[model samples]
Target: MKFKVVEKFTSINGEGPLAGQLVVFIRFAGCNLNCSYCDTKWANKDNVCYDFMTSNDIYKYIKSTEIRNVTLTGGEPLLQEGIIELLELLSKDRSLHVEIETNGSIPLNEFGHIENPPSFTMDYKLPCSNMEDKMDLNNFHGLSPRDTVKFVCGTMEDVQKSKLIIDTYELSDKTNVYISPVFGQIDLEKIVGFMVYNKMNGINLQIQLHKIIWDQNKRGV
Candidate 1:
């Protein structure tokens, strides 16, 4: 099946548990929700030029890179049709460690039964994002240690809400949970203080390393 591919490039995993690791990123176009801090807004616009590549073509491109880590990002990669086929094709390659960076509004259950399913780095859009109501809480039930639930906080309210979600779901017991500040919007120290005060044992704090390493507005990493 063909997919709308905005860009494909080799880069280090900028966020999540795989940070700093070499990866091949396949960025698809379009999204259902618009977060206040979305960096890839350019990719989500309807007129963005993109290539139409089949699952086999994408699989071959990843093989050419010879990079073991593959990150399927987006404008919400899950919004694409025929994504399951692509995931299945990628899973057949034993050498690849696939990860999908998903916006949390989508359901994860459909993806769970895939053989050797790709790990997910999901966003739990905090209130500051203005898209919190769109999140599908059921997705939390499908997480495992191989997955990550990330909260991008811009205020103390957002941090408190993140803590409530974490404790309510016991997300740390089910998966890797991370809290990061909205780039340039909140002080990192504030998030640290909340974590320290709450004794957030299993949560990790991260920054978008790519933004620090390169022009934050630059594409293709």
Candidate 2:
């Protein structure tokens, strides 16, 4: 089966635990949700131009890079028709570390059990995104420490909601939890103060390093 790939490039991961580290990014086309602060909205369009490549084609391109880190991103990589096949192919290479930057709406149960499954940087859409209701809470049931649950805060309410979800699910102990602001929308000092007041010990505050290193709107990074 052919996957609709929007672009492929080598760059430093801008978010998650792998931030600032070199990684091969294979961005697929299309998505199931649209968030207000989405930076990659161009790639999510149904009419977006893309290359029809088989799983092997993607694997070959990744191997050619000789980079150990491979990030299967989107539009929503999991939304691709044959993503599990692609993941399985990549897993055959023991040297490569794979991660999927997925929107939290999709269920992770099947993906989590795949052979040599890729690490997940799952987003837990907060109140501001207007997509929080779409999140699949069941996804949290199978997350390991290798996985991450990110909350993109755009307001004080988002921050408070993130804390509630973190505590309710005991996410800090189950998986890595991060609180990232919506770029220019939220104040870092307020987030820090809230964290301090609540003593949010295990959660992290992540910034998009790529956006800082390069133009925030520039693609193919």
Residue runs of model 1 more than 4 Å from their true location after superposition? none
- What is candidate 1's TM-score against the reference? 0.98
Write model 2 residue lDDT over 1-221, tens digit each, in one string. Answer: 89999999999988888888999999999999999999999999979999999989999999899999999999999999978888888888989999999999988888756678899999999989999889999988889999999999999999999999999999999999999998888899999999999999999999888888888899999
Error of 1 at 65 (Å): 0.8
Give every collision pair in model 2.
none
Model 1 CA lDDT for position 129: 92
lDDT for model 1, please: 0.93
- Clashes per candidate (backbone, < 3 Å): 0, 0
